[model samples]
Target: GVDQLETYFGAYLPQFFYAMLAPLTLFVYVCTINVTSAVILLICVPLIPVSIAAVQTWAKKLLSKYWDQYTALGDTFLENLQGLTTLKIYQADEYKNSQMNEESEKFRKITMKVLTMQLNSISIMDFVAYGGAALGLIVSVLQFRSGHIDMAGCLLIILLSADFFIPMRQLGSFFHIAMNGMAASDKIFHFLDMKESEKGNQEFPDNHNISFRNVQFAYEAQRPILKNINVECPMGSFTAIVGESGCGKSTFAGILTKKNENFGGSITIGGVRLSDISEKSLMENVTYISHQSYMFKGTIRDNLRMSDPDAADDKMWEVLRSVKLDGYIKEQGGLDMKLNEQASNLSGGQRQRLALARALMRDNSVYIFDEATSNIDVESEDDIMAEVHNLARTKTVILISHRLANVVKADNIYVFSDGYVAECGKHEALLEKNGIYASLWNTQCEMENI
Candidate 1:
């Protein structure tokens, strides 16, 4: 899009403007030299633009289809590349490769069509531009032979006649660039017209308590992920949201973190609706940490300081120790330890722990961990969850996890199934009632024993 915009402004637009004005200016001088030759040039001038416009109408639609196919193929290729390892593990690499080849073929066909349109347009444009100039030149020579115009006038008419086609001819070559720029402009305008999330000026309370009442949400029409869900986590309480994958456990966490905001019903913190709270105020009061933590290639201290730039060395150590990574950090040369790109040097557990430490640096009133412990070792998971439980002593904590054992002591547990809350209570209470949570607990317990 940026490249198209650059070409549009830098080349096509300038030449198009010159084409619009230059011909009329040249037409006046040609008339003064020989009226008959000038009329010939004038008649041919409109044919060049008319032919270009006719070609443009066809090329425009072709370019749009070309871009769509090209982007879709790219997305499919990237997705397949990322999952190459898994595809091989499942012994489906050849099948997946075949799918990619099929998509590429579709893209190739669309590309051929686009090139055909461009070539066809160029052919028509070449005929009009050169043909128009040829007709004017022939007329000027005739007028010169008949003594209607002198030698100097004939030469001037011929010389200036070439300049007449220069701008329009150049525009012919840049027609594709103009088409791409127009398509890019359509997307840019649509993006600019999109409505941003509404924000409010009212300040949120320091004591953050979260509640979702009759909440319903869906990524698209006819496919709801969360339905009429109700849950509560008052200040100084630990709440657990447990469900099978794809049952909207993560979506619920996203709602609280404001990553997914367009939904039905109400989610509020302390008596204020989540939508009404300013993003700045919400960030200051709530922090959401997930399993896939992004770490830039920089010193450990650099990453931690991003959470709170004013954090002192002791404050960094405090958070690190809380996650039980202080001893490891000290052994590795403290806060100056350099993390490789994407923190590749650190183990998965270490990366997750480091992310947890960063989240701890923020003094938010509520913290939600979206499977932050899912990829870590058992020991690290225990230490991190223990520290998180301690942190919930003064702040609201929402834990969304598949591991039910860790949340057995939670103040309340909400079990989601098929997009709605099936049960809500303490672990012991749910087990006593033999509900969804009880069934999940039993299954996990059995797996652990094996």
Candidate 2:
């Protein structure tokens, strides 16, 4: 597409300029030689510019529709390519191919319409230019017969009349290129005008005390994910937000990370409203890590450097050791080890620990682990939970998990149920009530015993 654009512009730009100037320039000289024929030619001049404007106005809409269809069809094709393996696994490849064909057909129809409009516009310009030239020739012959102009003058009138309309003929061929360029420019300007995320200049302090008062949120109306959820997470504390899947515990973590900004109620960190703190300052003091953390295709050193580029080798090893991954990494060629795409070479536990090490490199005042230990062996979970406990001694730590055992020693725990806080207390206190939290725990306990 980029190469097409470049070629289109290169071919049409000079022709477009010459089309505008050549006819007008020749018309003046034609008038000097034969006024009658030049007047006939001039009569057609206003009509071409006006018709060009009208055709261009109409082509603007068609061009936009054509581009939209082209993009959609490309996206469908790309999706089919990326999901080909999944389609084959499920024996649904033919169905996906049929879907792609339908999109391609739709794009083809729009493309035909665009070409029709371009040719139709060019046809109108061709008719006017030729009609004017014919009229000029007829007028020049009449003047010649009456002896109002000499033979040389008459001959010049006929030749110059063809020249007069030649520029318009060239411009007719450039119609598609000019319109496409304008359309592309309009789209870029629209992107430039898009609004950025709203933030403030207020800086966050060293304090990491966090609180959410009557916080409310929902991905969609009537299907609320969080409802007036009030909670507190003090600095230097280990706070656990635990619940069954789909009970809004992850949504609660999302709110703290400011992903769902339109939620109701105020959330503050260090006494400053989340919206009030500058993005740079807030990120420096707070960060989020999840079990599904992405490890890009690069060396281990490259991935760790993304968190803190200037971090020394010793610091990287220290964090790796803290997560109990240093010994394995050291055995596997140390930090220079190459990671496959999505870190497929490592086990799930190794990937999560590497993600943890990357997160720790930032030294943020508050860390939110949104289900950071959802899967993996018990040893890895124990190692990560222990590290989280140690980090909570200074930096604020908030854990979101469904594994009841992991949060038993948390300083405080908030059990959520159907978008609301069902219980808030230490693990033992919540267990004593034998309510929703106790029920979930007891079910898991019995399953473990089995």
Candidate lDDT values, in order: 0.87, 0.85
User: Model 1, stretches more than 4 Å misplaced?
Assistant: none
**Candidate 2 C-alpha lDDT tens digits along 90-123:** 9999998889889989988988998888778888
Per-residue lDDT value at 249 in model 1: 94
TM-score against truth, every candidate: 0.95, 0.89
Clashing pairs in 2: none
Which residue pairs collide in model 1, if any? none
**Which digits, one per residue and each the tens of the lDDT, describe model 1 over residues 1-450?**
457878888888898899989998988878888888887887787877898888778877777777777778889889888898999899998998888899899999988887888888888888888888888788889998998999999888888877888888898877787788887677678899999878766677765678899999999979999999998889889999999999999999888878898899988888988888888888887889899989999999999998999999999999999888999999999999999998999988889899999998998788888998997899989888898889878778898999998898799999999999999998889999997888899999999999
Give the runs in model 2 whose Cα sits over 4 Å from its true position: 1-21, 184-187, 221-223
lDDT assessment of candidate 1: 0.87
